[model samples]
Target: MSSTKDIDALIEMMAKLPGLGPRSARRAVLHMIKKRALLMIPLSDTLQNVAATARECLNCGNIGTSDVCDICTSHKRANGEICVVEDVADLWAMERSGVFKGRYHVLGGTLSALDAVGPEELRIPKLMTRIADEHITEVILALNATIDGQTTAHYIAGELETRGVAVTSLAQGVPIGGELDYLDDGTISAALKARKAL
Candidate 1:
């Protein structure tokens, strides 16, 4: 067997990770080899543990080591509000924002007619069930600003219309303290369309 075979295999595997290319993976593997005790060993052990235990939350589709995520299991987070997001990353982003106090529903992806993704493919049914089972009073659509995102929001809004749940969208337009000079035309138009009475 070649002495570098296993190391080459490791580099190949690392290259498949989200942000790493072959060149970067080689550098990362070399760095790990240099820091074997501090980073490599611990990282390998953690990766194995997560690979064995990490799972999608059954209730809300969040990624965790348990059937239900910590947010779903926490009594303090049972605030009767559910913020729907397109992906787990979006949910994490909202959490980092620290402005949303309620729980979340991580739809795996947006509804896509081209991809033939329907409500069952996502978590629409589970969301409706959660609304009834958890006594959800409001559903805040936190989808992205893309067409698929808005389409998904409108679909969810229609589903919740007669259920007595208040549906709201994320406010559109420029970001906090964003300069108009740096804004695009579409953003400016949306801001004007969403203008408030104040």
Candidate 2:
């Protein structure tokens, strides 16, 4: 048997993680092995604990250690607006921005006919329930700028319009310090359409 067989298996599993290729995973595994006493042991323990307790929040679909995530349970986050995102990663990204003070609703994924994803498969029905139960005044669609994302946004907008709630989308524009030459035509057009008075 190969002496490094177990370590190789660990590296292979780590490589399957997003953003970590074989080379990166090999380096990470080697580093963890070298720092076993300091980093590896603690990391292993933490991972085990998280694997045991991590769960999806029943109300909003955010992953947490409990049935309801901290944001969903917080009274301070019960603002009149709910920002809907395509996934938990998007929700985490929005939270990292610290610009939005309201709660979030994760849709799991965009509506993709190819993937057979539909509103029923996502948390759309729950979002409607939240709107009525929470007395939400506005819904901010923060989905990605993909075709499926836009389709999902439009579908949700149409649904909310009939319920008499304001539906808005995140403005598409060139990023701060981004040059016009580097932008796509659709981005340029969207920026132009959403231009504000100076």
Tell me how far candidate 2 lies from the true structure as C-alpha RMSD in angstroms. 1.4
Per residue, candidate 2 scores C-alpha lDDT tens digits across 1-198 of 253878989999999999999999989998999999999999999999999999999999999999999999999999889999999999999999999999899999999899999999999999999999988998999999999999999999988888988889998999999999999999999999999999
For residues 148-193, write the lDDT of model 1, one tens digit per residue.
9999999999988899999998898889999999999999999999
Reference-based lDDT, residue 63, model 2: 97
For model 1, the run of ten residues with the poorest summed lDDT: 1-10
Q: Candidate 2 — what's its lDDT? A: 0.93
- Give the C-alpha miss distance for residue 73 in model 1, angstroms: 1.4
Residue clash pairs of candidate 2: none
The parts of candidate 1 lying over 4 Å away from their true place are 1-3, 196-198
TM-score (all chains, Cα) for each model: 0.93, 0.96
